[model samples]
Target: MKVDYIIVGLGLAGLAFSRELEKENKSFIVFENKSQHSSKVAGGMYNPIILKRFTPVWDAENQLKIAIPFYKNMELLLGNKYDYKVDVYRLFTSIEEQNNWFAACDNPTLSSYMVPKVITDKFNGIDALFGYGKVTHTGRIDTNKLIEDYHFYLEKSNKILYQDFEYNRIDFNENKIQYKNIETSKIVFCEGFGIKKNPFFKELPMQEAKGELITIHAPELDIDFVLKSSVFIMPLGNQLFKVGATFNWKDKTSIPSKEGKEELLTKLKSILNVPFEVVEHVAGIRPTVKDRRPLVGLHKEYKNIALLNGLGTRGVMIAPTVAKELYNHIENDMLLRNEISIKRFENN
Candidate 1:
């Protein structure tokens, strides 16, 4: 009943951390209740640009270097092909927007990912008015399948426990933690928005956002690239495209709202003239923080307790490196950057 680590939650964050532990040959046990769906039902797009403003995402180059290979390794380890390399076609709304894209391409940091050439609208249904700017080194991950496959792998290795983690069951010590009969050198919390219920780390501010997505059968819209406008229309093949998502800060419920579906359809119609059928609608809560950075580091009060949450809309690109940073910080006393480290929230 003893191990090197007891990890709670098995979302992208937990999975990435577990991979690191396994690579190091560290013994650990994971508790997952399958309560969250943000990572599970995510759009899984890994773009380095802020498409809304035509600017580079924070640390895009470095994050891409680490994230791409990390997921590739996961594909090899799990013996599944979930990582996809596809271009993101950013539809321009106006001449001004196209000019701004030109400006972004001039940036040395964005030059690699942003293509200066304007692509003609290949599909008649898409409203590519001023043409589109294709973003390179961008792709999508089949996160649902990745999570499912990784879970099965963990179960096969007897490293995972399928249950909810009760906060009260844990006993904290100077150098170890005990939960029931299980004792571990440390415990890490990767509980997504579920961290709100964790008493030990609830003090940290987690501004959770609710997102809704829909799958549509757009037979005529045969496109290979990810389409971005007010919302993203991603090609999932088999004449099915994943269209989503609507972000609502006030309503954090997991239920798929009628209004959410209507909003998505409204946006989809604005860009796509083709008729489509809604195949499915799903909803999930994203663990977002006010500053829009990940939360990683040891707990302020308990040294052995750590947290890895708040990945927000870009979990696919951020989780791998953040998890590795958290692991190194714990195992080697490495310093985590102030922007991402939980230490920035001193009051917590």
Candidate 2:
């Protein structure tokens, strides 16, 4: 079969790219190996504020502006709301930290998103660490539902091929690329950590890290917004909460570990006074780059081949803008950002 583009991996990057292509009435095919992975498992939080040092995220304002509209449009197309706009209550752990947050809020750069407020009586069994600040306009994507709905849409449109990609099956010619008997003018890889095996772009600085998360059913905690201290508690409805995510830099295994569970349990105990049941545990590797940016560009020698991976943990927030940028570059002869282009590793 012939198509305009072949997209590998059906993660958020692939989905976002395909969504854009569909918007422009372009033809494409998507290949997905697994039904679930980092994208679906992710809490899908899009926060403009970085709490660690109280600084704004890079280009957050523009990213959020593009993302909010994109997801809303998708929701309209799907006839179901899949994204949410909510606030994040970052719990403070100390009086000193509270004072520091207040000071930081006064900074013009931080004041818009950060609201100085002490959350005390919001929930039951709450230990007053220090206080909390609200991050307005923060929200999460219901990635699980989005993926399912998109998969169904693709199936209905007959645009998805569910199989493991075999590199040996791909044929490259001077003018085109073919994958498993399907010919396309260009092929883009959105394969996440799987990019490590792509001979063309393996040299790119991708620091793949493993992350583990657990689901807890805490009926006593009626928190509607995301709660964060060291770890984050995202409300998943039905008195169920998704808590997690321990980052393991050295280990890249996707299997949940006993140590991960222990870490989550320990942290959960510190924040909640109510009893909860551990329901689910999962782990996946994030396609993180060393410079903490996405890698998007065409192969120097093979102009018809491109990569659209390395979204890291912020794939939900970054994918829309980057995909739009990539689409413009491919269709209108625009330039990819030097910081995200693969040229940086050419000499290495």
* Candidate 1 segments exceeding 4 Å error: none
Residues 1-348 of candidate 1 have per-residue lDDT tens digits of 999999999988999899999999999999999888899989999999999998778877788899999999989998999898999999988889888999999999899888888887577578676899999999999999999999999989899999999999989777778899899998999999999889977888888899999999988987898999999999998999999998999996888999999999999988888889999999999999989999999988788899999898889989988999999999999999999999999854
- Model 1: worst 10 consecutive residues (lDDT sum): 120-129
Candidate 2 per-residue lDDT, tens place, 5-40, comes to 998899899999998899898899998888338888
Pairs of residues at least 3 apart in sequence or in different chains that clash in candidate 2: none
All models: lDDT?
Answer: 0.91, 0.86
Pick out the ten consecutive residues of candidate 2 with the lowest summed lDDT.
120-129
Deviation of model 1 at 285, angstroms:
0.7
Give the distance in Å from residue 128's predicted Cα in candidate 2 to where it truly belongs. Answer: 1.6
